[model samples]
Target: MTQEYVYDYEPDYDQLMADIETLIQEGNLEGVRNLYETVHSVDIDEVLEDLDDSSLRYFLFMLEFEDISDLLENAEEDLQIRMMELYSTKELIEIFTFMANADVADLLGLLSTRRRKELLNYMKKSDSNILKMILSFDEESAGGVMTTEFISLKQSLSVREALLKIKDIAPETEIIESIFITDRQHRLQGIVDLREILVAPGYTPLSDLIEDMPFFIYAEDDQEEAANIIFKYDLKYLPVVNQKMAILGVITSDDIIEVMEQEHSEDILAMSGVSKDEEYDSTFASSVRSRLPWLLVNLVTAFMASAVVSLFEGTISQVVALAAAMPIVTGMGGNAGNQALSIVLTSIARGDMDLEDDWKLIVKEIVLGLFNGAVVGLFAGIILYMKYGNIILGLIIFASMIINMIIAGIVGFLLPLLFDHIDVDPAISSPIFLTTTTDIFGFFVFLGLASIVLPYLV
Candidate 1:
């Protein structure tokens, strides 16, 4: 159990942190190291995060460089910077050398350009160039997330030769469940499973064992796009390529799982109108930073809805009853709009729907809205009729409900698609726009009807 057991076992983290602190005070650094040996990287960072600056700086060098890399990878921005600052440039270079290139690149990405240059300069040219190239890619992209450590081979190699090659380099490669076979130019030909390589005759050519790749992505493509392909094809590893079809790296299934979770989180935040960049938001400021801008944008939409109501002030004042029923109409529309928007965004993200399917998709949502509105409106209208004993008012409420619901369906179906057409993220702004739309148009329909029927009611 090499001390990497995590929090799932309900370990008392407070007691552990206390022990580590006690050991540090007594000058028993070895005891502190043994206590943390069983701790997970996340748990290690959590304990480190609580330590005062002086204690943190002292304890960093107590742990091995490998453990240091783990903490740096999972730690918060401030903690990562602080930890790096405690180490000299030479020490930082040694620490980074112990990390995977992908992890090193990720940490470098958090630093300022000048600091990044200093660290990269300290590393060997080959490693420095690879990390630099990775840093050049957007962290949200396939190239950026991919680890450069992978097994690559020439098709000309026999199975025996490939096996010897894997034995020599397997420790250095990140994963070797499969080996990539490429041409002399390093253009990918196909992938072969380790299982297949082991069972085949030693004399068998590597080309004979090649499995057809379902798909490959460009390095610059979004990580979520790569995730979708890997999910759809059930691939364990997906190849990333450059424009020339030279294989850059493999995006493993683990990476895809992380990407999928991040994409899901983004969608959830988008629907809630929050822009999320952090998960370990421990402070009031972080919570406010995530939500305040979206709330401000939504305030503008609320004002638009309020303005729509103000336009009908005369009509609403005349039929004071309309004020009582206005919420019923807009509330139904907002709910319906959210339902359709969720479906659209999910389908678009999964590549299940495209612009070509727009007409049919729109027709289906609208029909669903109409059916739902008819049933709901009928009940509400009957209730209003029984209460007010005014057929005109009942009929007016009924018509308003149906019109608003249909309007909800239209905006829900069209807004996301429209955003996507303009190359914008469809999910991010749809909810705010959808709610405002339903409110504005719903008010117009209800108030306009009230104005028309005023003479009869009076």
Candidate 2:
């Protein structure tokens, strides 16, 4: 079997590429299928994505139903849709049945409405109903992201009976880390780990075997909250329930990891002023459209900063040195502010910061900003004093530096909070808004201070 060709049998890249080319050339369906069976599905998915459409279709048709299902589970959404289009209704239903409900819902969402309806009509009634139930929730909610195929046992059953029931149901369920215990009303009571079932006396009731009051998440809770609970408790799986304590489904740790990774990627894209769905293969026009709005916001803000500089044109012509040195103050303050803002925005996104704690964080940043400003400002003042031997010019730059830094820090801290209060993304606002504030204020402070102080020294 191809599984025998383990990681230790690493083929050289050129040899591996050559083998792929040969496989494409030979076009023997069975041989290509056997070759794919040797590698993990994730690796297969990557290889398939890299291949041109013809090679991908050839390799996909060679694989059996189980392998196709596994590969499709990890495939890109576009590829999944493409493959679904190729499969017959019966073949599609078989592969769809093998998928977890969360994955099914996601795949269905990516399909055209007409195709989605046609595919749903082909599914078993129970499977169709369950998929519809999952699809009803918002994609980011716990209900939407969870699997409905979790194992549940009645609290009255004996451990022996439970084991027999599990043997009957095991083939239908995937990743049975823990069995949920429910009451007559189907309200969740507790959880029994697989280890507990194995070790318990045959006559022990499930109520006795089940761990009392296990950790769980509400179905309406955000999916990230479910992920957080799993990560915090280091659980392999977590049960999802409704307000009445009736079990809904389970969120596997692997599923949570996927959600967290996607969320992190989306947040990074948002910070870069791109849409969440932006792809590397997207057309140039699409990429431009995604980034243009932010650039426009920045352009308007840039002109606003320039207007501040324009206000000081007289100050600029009088002292060319002020024009030369002003940007240094603003640039350093902007960098400092951006660094602080990035940390604060991350903390907010990760749910580490609370509404009440905003003041404490702001105060802490302001103090750090002042201390850093004082140190940097002192050095700047000494440099000016050495160069010009003018104490007024030195004092003017030092005072302006301190003022700009303090304002930059305030702008950084307050801008994120303001954005958060209005439900705007803080990361999107922090750099653009904070930099604008720092530049305009920095110019005004340095030039205004120089104007007031220049007569005394000159």
Candidate 3:
């Protein structure tokens, strides 16, 4: 009987680090290579990221050139730049050759102009030209992320000829799920999946296998727009065409996934009043710089809310309980407003809601606010009455709570729409504005009502 040895696929970061340390101390290059072979590329990349600078440099230097190239490609942008700095020009050029042109261009774009020029001078003319073309597009555009290494065949070719051509190019191309069908002028005509070609008769022309018109995006289109189109169509590879409708490159699903992740991260960070570039491992100065501006803006809004409270200071002096209860109104309003803000922002991001639905959405939120306020106000009023033994105070708080909640819903729904209209990112600026409105209105309503009913309470 043969015994099967099962390897643990789950990543154990500390154990892996210790093992690597032992291997390095013993100078076991073969053992390190064996360890690399056992781990998945992404897991290896994670392990490399966890290492200290010295350990990272040593491991990177000891690895095969191909392994280093793979690691660079999978690494974060900052780490890729660091690894690029570590390698000599000749070694960098060799590593670049193994990487996709899009990734090579991305790494080179991060380098200083002098360094980029020196590296570009060492690369082969053809590879340099490809990198230059990719660098020409904005980093957030489809052309920047798209790869030139896609299988394209003339529409005139027979299935057998197309298959042979694909076979020849398959070794060089990264994406073979779909073969782009182009005209003599290299204009995109249609696309045929490789499966269709495999099942079709060899005598069938490639054009016949194209079930529908080619769905492609322009090179200049925003990467997010491209990602949305790919998501909408459920495509694995989306062709990028030039202004003349000629095939330029292809954006794969993997690229779209990366874009989606980045956009999500940016949106979440923006909502929290932090810069998109500030990561968990960012320098203290960088993090402070990113967050301080927003905090300052919030401070101004806080003062504004404070000014509203000052208007009813006389009423508060008569009844100190009003001061104690003030936070409840403002805090509840803030929470309610945030809920509406989240819904509206998510709908806008997904393209489910637009400015045209502003009135409809605002009215719906206000109605929801009214219902929620009534429920919350009922319990709050009962609590206030029990605590103060004053029915008048209870009724005053109940009315104030209801009015503040209504204000919360209205302000929350409108702020994002208004920000969108002014071309400001709703995610970044909406929370600042929404919280201010809720705080100001919550304080104003609660205190104004108390002032009006002060005689009855005393």
Candidate 4:
């Protein structure tokens, strides 16, 4: 019988961090290195992010070039800059060789142009040229996120020859799961999986192994488009081509995964009225700077809602009950409007909602609002009637609730579409605008109705 060793897959993160900190403080380099080797690079990056600046620098110094490169590739932009600053030009050059070209380009894009040029001077001419080419493309394009290190073979090459070529360059290539088969002019012909080549006859031409009508994206296309394609097709690797269909580079699934995560984070932050660049651990001044503008906008909208309330001060004074019930109307309406806004914004982000069918979505939301409002308002009306013994007051509250909810639905559904049409991000601005609309209208309608029924209540 063979003895087996089982590892604790769910090791306590806090305990591991404590151990790492002790090792760092004691200057136990070998122990730290051994401990780090047991954890994944992503976990190491997370732990490094939490470490104090001095400890982080010391730990980074102990990492080999390959380990440092992996950390830099996985770390956030600010951390990447900090690590780069700690490294000398020669060290940076050595680390860059181990990093993927796409990662190198992204890291360089964050540096000052002068600094980028200086760093480039230390890299090989070929590597520097690839980074420069990637930098030439917009940061949000397929070309920008793609790695130039991919295996490509002429369609006419036999399977054995292609395998030999792949074997020669596999060590340098970032993606070997799928090989691009191109024409003599380097035009993308199709894609063939490495598994297919392994199983095919040695004499079979590479073209025979090509999948029919393989999916690819243009290098200049939006990075989101590439991400969407990868998601839709469940792809392992996607080829990037130019207008002439010439293969420029390849975007592995890992690149698209990163893009998706970034996009989701940005959308979530924008929806909360925070700047996408604002991090929780950012400097206090930066946090204030990032948030103050949105707060100011909300303040203005709050005053507008107050202005509507001021118009009905007399009604509230005469019937104190109106003031008691006022918040329910506006609160429910605001909640309803936000529901619509959330759905529409998500649909827009996922490219699900058609612009031309805007009216249909609006109508659907309106109907939904009316149905929900009727159910909610009925209970509210019944409660008011039982509490105040006034049928007219109950009727007024019911009508106001329904009307405000309808307003909420309309405003919420249309604002995002309007913002998108004007080339603004709907997620960032929609909630602010929708809240303002619901508040102003919710107060106006509820108070205006209360005033009309003031004689009966008083």
Candidate 5:
């Protein structure tokens, strides 16, 4: 018996790669399998990078189809595309057989229309139809991310009967946690925890075990909406339904997690004045096309900020310190506004902030802005006083900082609300507008105060 190499989180990738290569060279394929038997699939994914095209293809055949399905799921998009190119349709179909419906849809989505159609043609009509239906949904909808395979028990079934049914179908099911209960019409009634079924007597009726599940969503609902549903109700999984209330599929925790991450990424991109398309499009033309519009918008706002500065040129000429100090006010204001914007945007996205209660949130943010400004402005003012040896200048800095912070807060809070009301995404348009507001006001207030106190400073 050969001793197995056991690794936990971090595996020695170089050794694994070398050992596998050396075994393959020595014609000990069985030894290669045994050597990697205890190795993690993720570690295998890393070692795969060292292999050339031919070797990589050969190495894939050594792994089980189930493992390949997982690898395909974990692999980067480019590599996944390459893997698709490397495999014949038959081989891909075999791998797809082991993959979840959602995973198959995702992979199929990456393929060209003609190529995807070709693969679909080879699938069983049942599987092909299911895949087509899932693919037909917008990539950001609940149906797009949901796995079509799930266990649905008849509400009238006994515990023993349900257990027998699950046993027969569990292998084909995505996961078993909260099993959905449905009527004879296939309309979902409720969901019962698997634990409840296990604890109940074998003869106990499923209807007695079922609990109310008023949290189901239409298949056409946004994936983010589905995610919100999960968060709002603390659900493990949400059932997707048709207008008839018949179950179409299930959105599991994994799907919710993906939706959240993608949404956050999209929001971050939008806030940063970047498009979501730019994230995946690395080509120079694609980069320019996706990013140029926002860059131009920012440039325009930047000039507006500069124009505000030009109005204070006389004060700036008299005291050069004003030139250096003015930016600190505007920069700090920009930072403050961004902070408020992030909170408001997240609240709006999650539907946590009620329309009726908007005033409470607005007042809270404004107060927070004033409190932060007073404390932070004091520190900034002290620093200015020490640097320039002028009390009036320090006081001006202090006052201006407070004023700009307040303005930043108001703009940040209202900008998103205004844009959302007007049917524009606050995430995409708010940042640019906030930059202009803070810059113009920040310069005006700071410079206006400096002009008034110019005689004392001189």
Candidate 6:
């Protein structure tokens, strides 16, 4: 009997594109606007990028300000700038008011300095002040990624009043997941979500409606840590606060996702010794500059490994078998070390493990390496024994494999922690350092064993 095959579903992108063109030809802005809202921002951004400036602007104006903000956030910088050029200062300011403060600041920073200043003058004072505050922080910090447009309510307000207040501000604020409760001095007290307010009696004070103190991060906290907080609590938005407990802004889950993706990409690139964020659209000269430092580092490490090989020059000259087997030992050990290192790096990044637990992870990996080494070494020793009928030669290869592999596992675990202690990125340095150590050690162990055990073979 034959089993039926089932396939996963797919969306019709060709049909969607055709429909978009049909709507455009009919000059139906409402149909285009509706279609834009239904699609994901990433797809909408791609479609918008394909349109001429005039058509893009027409679509942008037709969509709600919220939809336009979402599309702009996901689009490439060049595309966003092109879209911005079509809006007048006044029209841009109007739309800017509706955007979260961080989004507004980011867009402003992308414009020419003169244009930024001119646009600032045209924007509402509150909107301008919020953008200025967000812009003041480094682009990679929590402050730079937060929104100042969260709803805040006085502790004295009754549930009914707070509900009315939220309704009044809902149209103005970027996020309404939580209503922050503040005291007379505008100090943070507690927070309540919309559901809590809706369920409570109208006459009940906000203090009674409040939940326990909500999770918050300082404006100065690293943006990466802020992302971790969101993951820990499964929060929709985490609050940013001052030393005095005055609520400043909010870091939303959407922003956290973007930050995490960029950080992971940076780590992966750095692991290959490349400098951070090598732009895909960069010129060849720019790309070369970004990668040159890493290539030089690899060259230095390769020479160090070659120096280890030089130490065994006499053994290789005496025994052709030693030279033939050296690459297998070193290459396998290096590969094993890298696999263990990747697991440790990912665990650290996910906050599932840390330096404090290093010993436990090290022991576990070492045990795994020894188990693997025994199996691989046994196969290699048996093959050598069968081929050359030399028990001594087989013993040398088996002993060398076990020793080198065990060393590889321990060194791989320690190397990254050492780099982290020295204020360097461990992921960036560990691979190069571990690879060099494994190669040198593997050569030394294999050749030294051969020299001592099989003098006749050499």
- All models: lDDT? 0.84, 0.80, 0.85, 0.85, 0.86, 0.80
lDDT at residue 281 of model 2 (Cα atoms): 92
Cα-based TM-score, every candidate: 0.92, 0.90, 0.91, 0.90, 0.90, 0.86
Backbone clash pairs for candidate 6 read 318-458
Instruction: Please provide, for model 5 over 300-340, each residue's C-alpha lDDT reduced to its tens digit, 9 standing for 90 to 100.
Output: 99999888889878889999999899888999999999998
Query: What tens-digit string does per-residue lDDT give for candidate 3 at 1-458?
Result: 22222238876877777777777676677777777777766777777677778777887777899988888888887777778888899989998778888888999999999999898888899888888889899999999899999898999999999989998989888888888888899999988889999999999998887756557889998897888878877888788999999998999888899998888888899999999999899999999999999999999999999999998889999999999988998899999988988888876765566786668767788788888988898889899999999888888778877888888888888888878778789999999988898889888888888888899877
- TM-score (C-alpha) between model 6 and the true structure: 0.86
What is the Å distance of residue 282 in model 6 from its true position? 3.1
lDDT of 5 at 63: 66
Per-residue alpha-carbon lDDT of candidate 1 for residues 1-458, written as tens digits (9 for 90 to 100): 22332344445778768766776677666665675576677776878888998888777767888778778888978799889888888888888877789888988887888989998888899999999888889999999889889998999999999999999999888988888889999999988999999999999999999987759999999998898888888887789899988898889888888788889999897788667574655477887888888899999999999998998888887778889888899999999998888888887887777776777777777788789888888888898888878788888878888888888998998888888888888878888899999999888898889888898765
Pick by TM-score: 1 or 5, better one: 1
| Better structure of 3 and 4 per TM-score | 3
Worst 10 residues of 1 by lDDT: 1-10
What is the lDDT for 82 in model 5?
A: 74
Model 3: which residue pairs collide?
A: none
Instruction: Show the colliding residue pairs in model 2.
Output: none
Indicate whether candidate 1 or candidate 6 has the larger TM-score: 1
lDDT per residue as tens, model 4, 114-181: 99999988888998888998999999999999989898899999999998999999999888888888
Q: Compose the digit string of candidate 6's lDDT tens values, residues 1-458.
A: 22222222333556655666667666776676667656677776666777887767666776776677677777888898997888788777777765667888999989998989899888778777777778778788888899887899989999989988898899878788778999988888988888888998999999887776668888887888888889878988888887888888988898899999988898898888776757777788888999887789889989998998888788788777777778889988998888878876776666666666667777777787788888888899899888877878777778778888888888877777667667688889899989999998998898887777655674
The local lDDT score (0 to 100) that residue 70 gets in candidate 2 is 90
Model 5 RMSD in angstroms:
2.8
Residue ranges of candidate 2 with Cα displaced over 4 Å: 1-18, 386-391, 456-458
